[model samples]
Target: MREISLDRLRTLVVIADLGSFAEAARQLNLAPPTISLHVAELEARIGAPLLTRARSQVRPTAIGETLLLRARRLLADADLALDEVRRQVEGLTGRVRLGASTGAIAHLLPQALEHLRAVHPGIDVQVQVLTSQASLAGLREGTLDIGLVALPQVAGKGLEVTPWRRDPILAYVPADWQPPARVTPAWLAQRALILNDSSTQLSRVTNDWFAAAGLYPQARIELNYNDAIKSLVGAGYGATLLPQEGEAAELDRRIVRRPLRPGLWRQLGIACRQEQVERATGYVLQALARLRQ
Candidate 1:
């Protein structure tokens, strides 16, 4: 099989960006004919015409368009790899891309990221805030360098999970109401509740909890945004079910928080694909470790 050459890929990128072979050649300091020959040789090796030439302009063929996308990514990765190698040798920098669940982001991630930046300023951290399901999906697809997710959900195949924290479930009650004598599913059902959006895995988990207990709350509203839910609960509209341990001052001041009886809780953890253990995943683990202590 013929190996694709960097020069060939560069020719494609140059032409695509500058919109003309002559312009690309001028910018690249190569003669126009040389650039044309490079592209033609690459196309012949690949057994496809890479460009559709018009009277005044040139465009990529379908296969060329696809190759163009991959070429850009390949070139970018090559550059990143070189930088990473140098940084690794010098112990100066690392890049980590992490997917975070909403609950984790609101509660634990800010402190973790701040500490990482303070201690390892050379390391670049990119965070993607998403639902638990989406976080898992991103990890599976290799787009996410690492992830923090609620446990049990992270125990799936192809990944490893490290327990990070256990957060309790808190009951948001009307401002005018006092703490219930005891927290129970039936007691929770007595209040008008504002629930998380139906699409969220958190919502599904909470709903399943209710179903298992043989009780259902009177849901007055169903929304996703935690801030919005807190706002509604603050206005004495209805109670909400928020994680017991995460940041909840907005909801706390307006409503009362009571830990559910029998200890209903969610476990938060770091998840990473096994293959990523030595790469960006290590950075995420190190960050979480420092934050915990």
Candidate 2:
């Protein structure tokens, strides 16, 4: 039997993902013919046609889909082996691609990253701000090493999730406006409300909180970034609800954060592929756990 090559397997995975040999070639920095040859070679070795090519697109055949699944695991294990060697020889020198929600990125990850950098100087971290759904998709697709996301997440097969923190969702109103010690959904519904964009889980949670009380406030504006939302709140455009980590001193002084009447909270946590948890990623997880403590 002929031996399979990791390079060819990686090429196959990329081609399957991109659905075009030309696009895969561009991504892998190889010629289109080279990609085609790799696929043809693999198909010959496996004794079956792996992909169905159309005029404009390509899709893996049934057998190809099975192979693609194993290919991902093989590639992941091979990378893990290399990362392990690098960690032992050079002291945790590797890259960790982290996905996080906007609120978590803005308030939570900075301190954890600072501690990681201070301790493991060689570990490089790249953060992508994404919604919980997008982050989970990235984890499944292997684009993200770990994700900090809002919880009640449905952990798919081969994914591990752990609680990180429970941040209280607070209402931000103009400093001059007199708010009750505990702001109620009804009370908030009477005022102009700024909220997170509909694309975010926070927005859904906020909407549910109001719906639970049978109140749906007309949102004055929907902004995605936390800073922008706070700026608008401080400018007195409207009151907005957001997750708060301790005191948000960064907000404009003209805005004041008031606790919600029912004390709504957003649960946050770390998620990673089960196979990816024993390397530099493990160290980062430890740091995050310590920070939470």
TM-score for each candidate, following the candidate numbering: 0.65, 0.68
Candidate 2 lDDT tens digits, 119-232: 998888898988888888999998998898777889899898888888888999998888888899999999998898787778889999999999877798888888888888
Instruction: Give candidate 1's whole-model lDDT.
Output: 0.76
Segments of candidate 2 deviating more than 4 angstroms: 1-85, 88-91, 276-278
lDDT of 1 by residue, 106-214 (tens): 7678777787777667777788887667778888887886777766674578877777777777777776877585467777777778988776766776787787888
Error of 1 at 225 (Å): 2.2
* Residue-level error in angstroms, candidate 1, position 236: 1.1
The C-alpha local distance difference test score for the whole of candidate 2 amounts to 0.86
- Cα error, candidate 1, residue 112 (Å): 0.8
Worst 10 residues of 2 by lDDT: 244-253
